[model samples]
Target: MKKLSVSILGTGFVGLCSAVCFAHRGIKVIASTHNEEKANLINQGIAPFYEVELEEILKEVVNRNDGNFKCLVGRKQAILDTDISMIIVGTPMGEDKRIDLTLMEKAAKEIGEVLRMKENYHLTVVRSTVIPGTTRNLVGDTIQKISGKELGKDFGLCMQPEFLAEGRSIKDTFYPDRIVIGEFDKKSGDILQELYESFYGDHLKKAPILRINLESAELVKYGNNCLLATKISYANEFANLAELVPGVDVVQVMKGVGLDYRICERFLGAGVGFGGSCFPKDINAIKAFAQSKGYDPRLLNAVLAINDDQAIHIVDLAENTLNNLSNKKIALLGLAFKPGTDDMRQAPSIRIINELKRRNASNIIGYDPKAKESAREVLGNKIQYANNIEELLKDADCAIITTEWDEFKILKPSKFIRLMKNPFVIDGRRIFSFEEFDKELTFRAIGRVALK
Candidate 1:
């Protein structure tokens, strides 16, 4: 009998969100974090980061524990109490663009040590995104070396990749497009299915139970992310070319292309390029994995090169319009890669901001509906933060829109023109219609005809 005590290793966005989901569903949860400060915050039912409805969910779980849900701080209590553990630690990319397994190694070593002192059959499930064979090579090896116990006996392992978007994490969790389980064997697969069964209830019997080998499962995550990244890159490539072609509006072109049944459009918006944590990290991991296998990752290299170029290229256009950013106050309209969440992990805004710095842009006014705090953390005091859109663009020479927040789309271009010193708008994202702008304001968009 698998006791329903669940311990989550790593309480970042995915970890905490998963913990809340399980706990709310009457599953006892002990969420752990490496940092003491983070653990305490989570224990108090306060969300550590900016996520939509996370605080409300955490509060509900913590306040109404009723014996089913609980938040356990520190490593000792977490490992000691639970028989089923889910590792949700991050696997950051290294300087060489390889998957940095440092956090994963540490978590595995700790789990191995915990296993060494335990007698129960521990089910270790990895919910982190990793390369193929990472579990067998790194995690499995670490457990064997540290626990001094043979695999398939003392403990069972499986890979459960996360597929949550930053903003809609909770929604995606409860209603994931599909649930993927990568197990070492049928036994491990069955164990995971049982654990996640309650979430699906009667639908469990009908849900796709893709029981594949560990490596295939791992590759699935990277493959999914890379494909999405590829779509964005392809879109941007066309968007850039559209500018040279007369009478070509990339937006319309994409809309026409997307109408086809084959290419259902989602990441096809050709803006300032794709950003955020998953796409960039997973793409690099794939590239590294291919390089390790002695395969030339030329496509991956191009994908990254194009994204970087597009992001930096926006700044170049902005600089040209404004005649140098140095000592020129520039208002950057959007900060987060996408709207609906305050997560700025690997945002294209980083490249744009860095470029601004390089060109000695004296001041930058920035605003995002959700990602202000995260943007500040990444940008520091270099750029000024505006709590509102009007405040951000007010008194600025020119404004650049990096992120395509829905708010920006509805915002009147004349209002931005009214607020700025130069009244010039560089639409990194073609969020506004060219016809909407007046003749005086300079409006430029990527891969589209510039409206004078």
Candidate 2:
């Protein structure tokens, strides 16, 4: 079970993170990526992107020089060295908001070329977020065509979806809730399951490993993500309703709703909307995929409508509060989609800024404790960047809490009152207390009707 080494293709969040975590566990890991610069950074013990609790473990794993982990650029040799190859490539959402399998197909071809020449039977696992039937239909066909290998006898294939949160990827990898393996056959599933059983020795006791057909495994990731997104959208819908009824807070409403034995309180936070790489993209793909198959997902459509409207609603809230955004210096508290990550893929802040720009608001400043560089990449000179919270709030006519950073939550009302020219605040994240902020400044929030 523990005899085999692993090769991960791609340097995306799941790829590099899984490679490093596996190596840290003393398993031999050879990862391949096209990005030479990112490879250099990874080999030097530096993570190219920011993720919580990644760097410290990564530095130790790299410095140990135990030959457990090494990232290379476009090498079939890496695949040759490892017994298992995990294609962790990106399945990006195209402009049409559908899951694009270009990268997935390319990765399969790369592995197929490697497997063609190899004498030893190797296992290939697709660990990327993909639509149903992708592993069995698209990936399996391409690999078999290139390698001239029999499906179950020549080599192995598995689709193991990773359920990793961006900020807590390391922790999730080490102690995941469950392991879902969609295998080509019993042989393939057994090999992949053995690896996990070996690596996560005692974790199997708590987290059951589910072995299923490839299509079911692929859809599980989408179902999990879509349901979570729906919960977020559902909470948001209630949060908005709470605003209409005075003396009602969604926080209290959800806390009670969460007390039920079935409904957990994980994604029920009333906020601007769900963003980042997973929720929006996954939900959209599954919805589009379902519609293409001639079954329209009414719930998902509603979820998307509610989420898309959230950003516009926030901008509308700001306009109503400030009477007009023209000639006003607006400050965005956080730029990243969420805290402990620099991921800003579909961040509501971008939508809000675009709406503000449409309304002719030119002076916009933003600050994020950890996402400044990535923010700059996405928002290149679109707005002034502040060195800190005080810097962003300083001389600003209105402040919008776009992200709920820990540092931003600790901020007192007096701080914004002292810093801003107008001291007008909009709580998009609902981090600050409505009672405190509404008492101190001309404050407006997404949820919770004003008590004054």
Predicted model with the maximum lDDT? 2
Roughly what TM-score does model 1 have, to 2 decimal places?
0.95
Query: Scored by CA lDDT, what does every candidate get?
Result: 0.83, 0.89
Q: Which ten residues in a row have the lowest lDDT in candidate 1?
A: 67-76
RMSD of each: 1.9, 1.0
| Per-residue accuracy of model 2 over 160-271 as CA lDDT, tens digit each | 9999998889999999999999999999999998888778999899999999999999999999998889888999999889999998899889889988869988888877
Name the 10 consecutive residues with the lowest summed lDDT in model 2. Answer: 443-452
Candidate 1 residue pairs in clash (backbone atoms < 3 Å) = 239-447, 326-360, 327-362
lDDT of 1 by residue, 302-403 (tens): 888889889677887887777867777888888988877787888888888888888898798899988888888888998889999889888788888888
Candidate 2: C-alpha lDDT: 0.89
Model 2, C-alpha of 80: deviation from truth (Å): 0.6
